[model samples]
Target: MKLLMFIKELTMLIKSLRGLCLCLESGSGDKLSNCTKQHIQKLLKANMMGPYGSEWAVEEKVKRREMVAPQARYIFVYWNANEMMDNAFTPLLGFLHFRFTLEEEIPVLYLYELQLDSSVQGKGLGKFLMQLVELIAQENRMGAVVLTVQKSNSLAMKFYISKLRYVVSSISPSRVDPLVGVEKNYEILCKTFDHEAKAILEVYSVQYRTARRVGFMAAFSDLKFED
Candidate 1:
């Protein structure tokens, strides 16, 4: 079956560009309009290595491919038409992969990955793409938008937490059992759209904070990190 394509255009100030002009294209795995899976894979491999070192990157790449390849319908590809390289049709600035699912029985949009080229990292593209995702969720009547972030990636954590107003999910693995989950490297984060979803999600965040406090006290009661 041929997948439907949705193209959205917006104006933004890019460091390398003269004026506001960006395009977001959405398509399924079978019908990528102007790019290929290889292109997306290359972008992912290039941008997803800061937090996760090269040791398990190959394995992780495979896992990511498996997740996104099957559900490309939710992939949002960001293109910069003016920065094309030799023989390339469009400059692949970044992409967002997500899907709709039930989180705590609440229908939500789960963002799998949002990656941008190093050249385009700090130019507001990230926030623009994220806002677009929330718009997508709201249009579909989803209760919330969710994503996971690596704890070690302080830049990303700050972006999501401070700029995007996302909070660590109450039911995130680490929050659920901090003592045992203390070794986890990632945290699930979310942004809810409605009063009902906000109330439901806030309960989890409060519970998690309480649990984390207890865990922190217990963890430091016997041991300490030496400087």
Candidate 2:
């Protein structure tokens, strides 16, 4: 979808959030300033470096430039001056970077990053942002809200699953084939809105289960007979 169309569909979404202490503004990646991009990088590094571990260096390079891609859409969050204790200026609190695209042939709002400053962690701001993303996906007729979470980030995994009700997508590597999935460090998570999306994204197909069973049996057969 074109950027203009994407903005037109959800312009009111951000406007409706004015009552929130944390103001939200929509912007395309192409329009972000170098300063703003640097801010995003810093926030991401703070939140992700630990979870990413040795892979962080490589992933950081990808995210640093990916945030400014023309097709990327962002919801920039800012704290109101009154909410700040030290400074009178409103500071950037966080951002949600996403794209409208197809996943497994289904149109989806794929969230690439949801990074928040350390000060705002655990406050429900993250959940609020996710809710907004879901609303935007629905408003645009997208099938689901999809995101990737590192398996090492247990807190993030729990937040998305326990708090938000996101499921391990059937297309997720682990769900598709546990044997092979053991090598993967991340999982694709999703919240589906309709039956079609639920079936395609959330339901574990028979084939996947069969693969798991076959792999388990094969492993058993290879074990030395001790009896």
Best by TM-score: 2
Per-residue CA lDDT of model 2 for 1-227, tens digit only, reads 56566576456554545355666789999999888988898898889999999999999999977888999999998986567688744367899999999976799999999998877777767877887798789878899999999999999999999999999999899988889899999999999998888888899596865786798899999999767
**Regions of candidate 2 where Cα sits further than 4 Å from its true position:** 1-20, 82-90, 204-227
Supply candidate 2's per-residue lDDT for 74.
97
Q: Please tell me which predicted candidate would have the highest lDDT against the true structure.
A: 2
What is the C-alpha lDDT profile of model 1 across 139-213, one tens digit per residue?
Answer: 788999988887888999999999989998876777677875688878989999988777666456656557767
Prediction RMSDs, each to the true structure: 11.0, 9.6
Model 1 error, position 172 (Å): 1.2
Q: What is the clash tally of candidate 2?
A: 0
lDDT per model vs. reference: 0.71, 0.86
Backbone Cα, N, C clashes tallied per candidate: 1, 0
Segments in model 1 whose C-alpha atoms lie over 4 Å from true places? 1-20, 30-35, 58-64, 74-90, 205-227
